[model samples]
Target: MISEGRYKNQKAIIVENENLSMSFLPDTGANLASVVLKEENFEFMVQRPEREYRRVEFGGDYVEAECSGMDDMFPTIDRCYYERFPWSGTELADHGEVWNLAADVNVKGDDRVDFTFHGVRLPYVFHKNVSIIEKNTVRIDYSAENNTDFEMDFLWAGHTMLQAEPGTRVIVPEDCTCAQAVFTDSGRIGAYGEEFDYPVYRDKDGSLRDMSVMGERQKDSEKYYLKYPLTEGMCGIERTNGRSFTYRFPADRVPYLGLLQNFGGFREMYNMFLEPCTSPFDRPDVARLMKKNCVIPPRSAYDWYLEITVR
Candidate 1:
């Protein structure tokens, strides 16, 4: 079934089959707010905190209200100036320009839906399509086009967070090694940009810290971007109860996978993020410096896709 509805006081569109159900927010960032299994009622996506949500006025921040759930990061993740790109302006906002704006939702047939957003600050258009390909798998296809007469460089990432507890196991490709854990005020596991093997890192004090799971680490907050290439092109996290969520995407299209753990840190929220990004770094400027930013020619389009399965 397909229908329009409201979730968390925000406008949303829902699509479902016999086994899977998903919700998409059309007016706000076009976020895929929720995904769940029907019979078991097991939700796979992390939702925003339960509170009265008010639309932010101009110059107000939206981060405080829309931090959880799934979001699309485009153009850039970190704010910076545009250099080399045709656009002569500052980089995209905190999490990019889409989240702050509304999107147009189109229901394609019974099993597919598309959410589209046109850029305001830059000359570009982004489209995302969600389709239930199987009873257990949902496929997401993304396309971004440059509407200008010059080439543009940008970054894209699927900002997906999942509800996790102490026993949730976060899995990555076997080749994934060497990670950088971002430091935060609450406390950090390692230094910024410090490279260490996956799931295990030596702290400055020579103590080994495990990154494989978010376990009983209260007041701990850290962000890690893995340096290892996605040799297997698949990763996931499974709860201790045996329920799991797996993601599959081509490594050539999305090169980096980021792991964000906020255990009673960062506004006292507990959730973990399994992100797939086209570039290794989040900042456009940093990506440009590293020569990893994606390029779109004038009037040309770029396309990629990923799939998620509930097991």
Candidate 2:
């Protein structure tokens, strides 16, 4: 069932089952504020310990808030002006347009909740539904419809940041052996726009690094996308205690996967993001130039889904 709750001192709406519990901040960015795996007595989502939520404007920085749980990144993830005519030069927010705004909530009353947000600056409506479809599985479905007569270009990624600790192992398809670097905070990787070996890499200091295993808190951070679409369409992290959770999606629909490994570099927090996006680039403008933007045709909608299962 769904009820009122609080996450990080912000007002929240909660949806729970006997095995799992999810907290949401419907009015503040339609965020999935928290996720708890009841069987493991674990808080699945990262909680930036001791940080309070900060109020922000439409064009404000996403980092200004308690950067935890899941925030819907729509239309664009990075702030950039619209790339096409009719809306060119229209600036999108730092982390898309939906965050930090009140969303209309529709409770489905069966361990499910729906949130709808109309673009404040663009021409579309975004809808996301959270469902506890199985005892230990949470499913999220998303659809965005173009409201204008002309087709539109957009990107939607669920920015779910999971709690990380030393020794946690990231699981990808066994045959996948490479990653394309998009962002990195250290010289361990070859900086941005580079391709590197998967899970193992030689550090700048000439040390062999296991990229898949989470390490202790430090100033190091790295992010990359799977160089190619997964043949199996799944990824997960096996925890120190052997308990784990995996995300499954259709590879053809959401062909790109991003890993945001932040041991401590960004805000001194330990967390990692499993980003299933439509494009490899975080900036839509850049993605458009790279011919990777997903589009919704006039009077139509595009859809995708994600599922998380815990062991």
Candidate 3:
């Protein structure tokens, strides 16, 4: 069922069924604040320590706000200037625009909530529908329209940060044998742009690291991009408690995948981000420079869907 609830002083829209329940704060970037597996009575989202939500500026830093759960990373992932003609040098927000603006929410009975957001700086409209489609499945349908005549390069990532433990392991397609190190905080893996064997990785000093499994809080964090489009388009995490959540998407629509490991590195938190995205990497300008970013046609719309099965 869908209900209006107050979560730690923030306006929350909760949609649930018999198996899963999701609570998202529409006022705070429409953040998916909570995801509970009903059978296990377990929370999947990484809990934010902040009790209250505060409004963020149009181009403010994302870290300054409540850094929790899933925040829609759109148009771009990192702070960069629009590189195309006419819009060149236009500064994009740190984690895109939607995360800072309030979304107009529409609740449909007990199973669906649709959020619509008109862009403040960019010329586009974004829509996301969060719904419970089955007892063990949650579905999210996403779409965006380019309101301008000029085509624009963009990237969209499903930035879901889940609570993780040492024994948790990440699951991907068998063919995704390697990944590129896109970003690193402590250089625990290798430098940026370096590619390594997946699951079983040999680090710089020849340390055999099973990258699929989580280790201790090593004060390090890194983001990895699958070198190629995932034809299978599947990713998930197996928790230590025997609860596993799997994500499935269309390979043609959301073909790229990224994995973020935050092992007591940034903000001293332990979590994991299994990002299913459009582009192979972050930063729209960089992706555009590499001729890999997706572009919405002039006056046209783009659409995709993400399905999650928790068991």
List the global CA lDDT of all models. Answer: 0.78, 0.82, 0.85
The TM-scores of all predictions, comma-separated, are: 0.93, 0.94, 0.96
Off by over 4 Å in 1: 49-51, 57-62, 186-188
Model 2, CA-based lDDT: 0.82
Question: Model 1, 1-311: lDDT tens per residue?
Answer: 67888887888888788998888888877777888888899897876556644456322354655666677888777766677645666556667777666888889888888888888777789998888888899898999999778988888888888888887889898777678665654444556666767777666587787778776857776777887667667778889888898889988888888888878776676778888888767776687676776777788998889898987
lDDT of 3 by residue, 240-271 (tens): 98888889989899988999999988889999
Model 2: worst 10 consecutive residues (lDDT sum)? 48-57
Best by TM-score: 3
- The deviation in Å at residue 28 for candidate 3 is 2.2
Cα RMSD of all models vs. native, in order, equals 1.9, 1.7, 1.4
Runs in model 3 deviating more than 4 A are none
Give lDDT for model 1.
0.78
lDDT: which candidate is best?
3
> Model 3: number of clashes?
2
Kindly give the stretch of ten consecutive residues in candidate 1 with the minimal lDDT sum. 52-61
